[model samples]
Target: MNRDQMEGNWKQFTGKAKEQWGKLTDDDLDTVAGKREQLEGKIQERYGKTKDEAKQEVDNWFDRNGW
Candidate 1:
């Protein structure tokens, strides 16, 4: 899904996101609120990933999920 679609459907994706990134807390996902940049930031913070790594991971997740 695109950014707006992801944001719109965030509640639905949160479960899968948690599945993929188990280190993230509910509070972190809530803070993300489906904004891609925020999601990337949270991934970076929780996973100690660089910006590019987080972005790439999100891209891969999006491609796999296609939601």
Candidate 2:
């Protein structure tokens, strides 16, 4: 999903986000609050991923979820 769409539908997507990245806590996702850059940073922090890797994974997740 695009940035606005994500921000608007963040509540709906949070469950899927948790499913996709179980290491991330609800508080972490809440802090991200559907901001793509923040989501990438959180993923990197929780998963020990590089920035590009986190971005790529988020992109892939978006595709998989058809968001």
Which digits, one per residue and each the tens of the lDDT, describe model 1 over residues 24-49?
99999999999999999999999999
Query: RMSD in angstroms, all models?
Result: 0.8, 0.6
lDDT digits (tens) for residues 1-67 of candidate 2: 6799999999999999999999999999999999999999999999999999999999999998888
lDDT of each: 0.94, 0.94
lDDT for model 1, on a 0 to 1 scale? 0.94
Q: In terms of lDDT, which candidate is strongest?
A: 2
Off by over 4 Å in 1: none
**What's the true lDDT of residue 9 in model 1?**
92
lDDT, residue 17, model 1: 97
* TM-scores for all predictions: 0.95, 0.96
Minimum summed lDDT over a 10-residue window in model 1 is located at 1-10
How many Å off is the CA of 56 in candidate 1? 0.2
* Residue 53 lDDT in candidate 2: 100
